[model samples]
Target: MKRREFIASAAPLGLLFSLGLGDVPFANAQTAGGTPVPGGVLNVAVSPEPTLLTSAFITTMNIGQVSSKILEGLVSYDLNLQPVPALATSWSTAPDGLTVTFRLRQNVKWHDGKQFGAADVQYTLLEVWKKLHPFGRAAFANVTAVDTPDPHTVVIRLSSPAPYLINYINTYGAQILPRHLYEGKDVLTNPVNNAPVGTGPFVFKEWVKGSHVRLARNPDYWQKGQPYLDGVVFRFIPDAAARTVALEAGEIDVALGSSIPLSNLNKFQDKSRYSINLDDGRYLATIFLTQFNVRKPYFADKRVRQAFAHAIDRNALLKVVFLGYGKPATGPVPSSVVNYYAAQTRQYPYDLKKAAALLDEAGLKPGKDGKRLRIALDYDAGGGVTATRPAEFIKQSLARVGIEVELRGGDTASYLRRVFTDQDYDLMISSLHRLPDPTLGVQRLFWTRNIIKGAPWTNGSGYSNPRLDTIMEAAGREADVARRRALITEWQQIVQEDVPVLDLVEQTWVTVSTARFQKTALQGDGLFASYADAWLTPKKA
Candidate 1:
């Protein structure tokens, strides 16, 4: 299997982050030093310090949390998966529907006291479209050009009537940047990644590397009298247990991206210290699995891949690895994304007999010398949520079908380097975050170009299929979403039959917070999309 073929066959379940800079003195939210109504600071514990801080290149949750607060996108997705105004108050499409014009909000002002205009909007798209800088390539992939007609009106010209462009534009990667501050080579070493300036509700305060990042309210923010909290602080805590402990001890006001173990869920729920919200379907979901390198002789045959998939006992896996929170995956696209995902579409039920049968069919028989199919699996153990136990359960399940599973664990930095840059794994097990736009979600993992040999973002499995490639490209350029979804379903069908990737389960995420924080929702996409609309209820202390 070629590198692109591997990506197309792999099922994706992951998220990313970015970082940028700006630094004003850190001021305590406490009403001291003559700052009126010094608001209470909300403390957040993050897992790691982000590598890239720019809106275009953020690849982890740690950097995303900070960037979201400091930056604003042209459009924003609401809880119901609808687009709403952000930097742009309203927009209209040209007669051909390929050109879109957006009118910016008049009162918006950057944190640095600079007035935001169409020039900034035009500059951002132009810089990102050129791909001369890092991370800008992914932000505006379908954009052909951008035009700023006036101070408050911006137009975007598309290569085609791309259906998923709206959804893609509102994501973390497309956050509008300050054109003046980030132009030319200066962006390579821009100070904004460590300290950012934006027109969001919060303004950058300070960042103590390896410790915490601080943000203060933008008094003259575009939205009047918003962001009730005077400031917010994100504290970096790599350990999940430590994050839970801090929340209970009041050391932090909110904890994101970490899970409270299922065994401890009942205990925590009974206590009033915090409220637990679990979308079991969305949070505790499909078991995490690996995409075998079809390029290898042992797994090259379709029968071998199918045999390996059938060998794993998903029923036992849910009980042991997920603690009964999630269920076995029926197909590549989770049931949460579509209601019609049924056994008829794709179901690799656990049948040891069938697995052994397929193994024999593939010409791999148990030899007298006890030689069996032995494959090394790479697993990231850098902490957070998924790495805790699922990987071990996967190893045990694969062991039953004459496959010797060697599970390798490493630090975060080393794990990413090996997976993305080195192409050094026979089997890889990593979690993915699904998006409403299946084309964007699926393409990110399966597109052949994303995994060119030696490229950092290569989808390591090296399983490729041409049919999938045609379907993905067609779906991306489709103008009608209904048609796009149909094409995506077709693409999903191809991925399921290929067996290069064995999707174990769809993981669910639980958010434990105070009930007083009304309108706080962890969207299915796992983003605080409507956070700005959230307001604290005075009904609770």
Candidate 2:
């Protein structure tokens, strides 16, 4: 696809009317603003206080949402889902495509007032990203070394061309960390994880455990007169109903990650106090998934996996669980990713008879109770009703096919431990941000090499297909957009057939904010946004 076509295709669905611009696009709405009034605390509602503050260790959207205020990557995705400058002022790739050079922004200071330069970017990529980040390890697998020619320039040398490296860096893979603070210490356990220091708009002030995380504006922020709010307070309200009540009662300025229940979305739709955006746009590339542990005997058989897929009623689940806020997903990549999304792939329509036949064909016979087999299902309770309700619905649907599902739930930590670390569950229902490019987000979920023992959100399924692996690797290395897209189409076909992870629904994540907050430019979902450019409009007298 041409650059302009791709940008338009990836742009957000139309702006909701609550913004009062009469259907103007969000990007254009920013330019229609009055003078930005600075000096008010933007209270945000986030479910389940973040377990970790650093994106270097885990890539959870919740952590990124909170950390983006204080931390910054080398590049960030604009409203069109295209990589734009962030900490790096400019960057260019060599003719051979094996090298990328970045020119750093000079005079930018970390939250601790230290100079932000090449060494920090070098350390972040070499020590942290390549070795630890879930997506980074795959995206930068071919990066041979990072060279700092001067104090303000970085040149990345790769063994082979990696077409998607820049996209990964722009997303969550390359969140720059200060070399001064973590150079000699235990990077993972360093105290800076809780009290992080970065060159972003906000300064880490205090984190009151179990209540809220508070951040104050950085007076010396490199971008002049930005980060209009005096501070931002992320209130930890785990209950979806409570978050809705808070938004309704004017207790919070914005609800991050669409924490409010979908059932209650209409409550605030036309309210004069708030506006709601439910299109999910290019910024929030995500899909609800039903992942299987391929190592387990029950799910090891592709027939059984296909049977389970047929048992799911995605349209009904969309209506009941998401309250018609999403579309039935056909595969791993969402339709919003227009460039590489494969529409011709095989689809599993809801059919209990077909599901039962597949189960019987797989050598499974129903018992006296008309149940074929028993297995455990798990999901993260911290995701609020959105995740939990879908798992419940799946359980009931699977039971109809003579599969007895034992439903389980836990907080975020336990969920990560059980699924990613322990590999304790037979099935897991979860959602993952699909990202604008497949290499940045999707590969890690299925690639065998990414099956890290303790890493959260890696390939926990223990699935390994040599052909699929080769296609993925080739796709990453291919610089030609047309050839790369064709390879991606083939990869999606294999994934849909393998059933390593069953795609359920493409969520239309709803983000609601009070009318007082204006020009909220979201960065990849509402999980992260350009808060520094966000300004608050004055309240009526």
| TM-score for all models, in order of appearance | 0.84, 0.86
How many Å off is the CA of 306 in candidate 1? 1.0
The prediction achieving the highest TM-score against the true structure is: 2
lDDT by residue for model 2 (69-94), tens = 89888888865567778888899989
What are the Cα lDDT values of the candidates? 0.61, 0.76
Per-residue lDDT for 525 in model 2?
Answer: 36
Q: For candidate 1, lDDT tens digit of each residue in 215-334?
A: 887888887667767777878776556766777676866555433434444445532345544331141123355777767888778888888788887767765665554556766666
Error of 1 at 488 (Å): 1.4
Stretches of candidate 2 above 4 Å error? 1-34, 279-284, 296-298, 365-369, 381-385, 410-425, 451-456, 520-522
Evaluated against the true structure, the overall lDDT of model 1 is 0.61
Candidate 2, 498: how far from true, in Å? Answer: 2.5
In model 2, how many backbone clashes occur? Answer: 3
Model 1 regions lying over 4 Å from their true place: 1-39, 51-53, 93-97, 129-139, 259-264, 278-287, 339-344, 369-371, 384-388, 413-422, 520-531, 534-541
